[model samples]
Target: MTQNGFEKTGDDALDAAFAAARAARPQPSAALMAAIRADAAREAAAAPRAARPRPAPARASTRPWAGFWRALGGWPSAGTLAASLVLGIAIGGQQAVPLAGLDILAPASGPLDEAAVADLLPGIDAFLTEG
Candidate 1:
């Protein structure tokens, strides 16, 4: 089942397209590769190093909105805060509107009946109708 018995050879380790099978030849030491590595190391070591130019310092922003950015770090914009405050005031007005003259809901409406609520509710018609 092996194609040229290369499968048992494991991976593509010996699958050099241009080279003949090892059974027909002998491997040699990689003296050529060693010479190439040494040459590259010598060239890299002997090369003159150039100093990198320092970058200009970051300019301090004078924009008025910069303070707002610094204040919240990354909070919502001023218009958003104003809009939220408006929405809060609008919703708060609903609850406040239900109250009479900004006074307490209890005293302004009068005291609760001391009688049990069940009795009052069940005989509500009679209690309210009767003097």
Candidate 2:
């Protein structure tokens, strides 16, 4: 039964057409299947028995510090940085700044010091004219 809007009509033509179409469906030929199987077999036989599987790609980290660590070559980088830090601390401790022995009151006999220019500052214009 086929219905148009609210009206219904008793019809068997639509059902028969669908049944006929379904019965006429095509299938793959035997030759096609044989060719596909032959290709698969040939490829399998040609493959090396001792062929190694490919290694999986390294997973990159999403953390901000991960890039920093990776750039330093991971554990080796960390060890180098640690060694440098330890050596720096050891050397620094051995040679300390001599703040206590600094003599600010002593004569500034060195170049560009106050004592070096003190004697020449009073007669600055006379010195300049003489030059």
TM-score for each candidate, following the candidate numbering: 0.27, 0.44
Residue pairs in collision within model 2? none
List the candidate 2 regions with Cα displacement exceeding 4 Å: 1-36, 47-55, 95-113, 116-131
TM-score, cand. 2 vs. native: 0.44
* TM-score, cand. 1: 0.27
**Tens-place lDDT digits, model 2, residues 71-99:** 88999889999999999999988965557
Single out the weakest 10-residue window by summed lDDT for candidate 2: 1-10
Candidate 1 per-residue C-alpha lDDT over 1-131 given as tens digits, one digit per residue, 9 for 90 to 100? 25564445444655563235555675555997788889999988877655435676888789998877878645556668788999999987874445455333254465765454444468776776788
Please report, in order, the local distance difference test score of every candidate based on alpha carbons: 0.65, 0.71
Runs off by more than 4 Å, candidate 1 = 1-51, 54-71, 74-76, 94-110, 116-131
- Name the 10 consecutive residues with the lowest summed lDDT in model 1: 96-105
lDDT of 1 at 2: 59
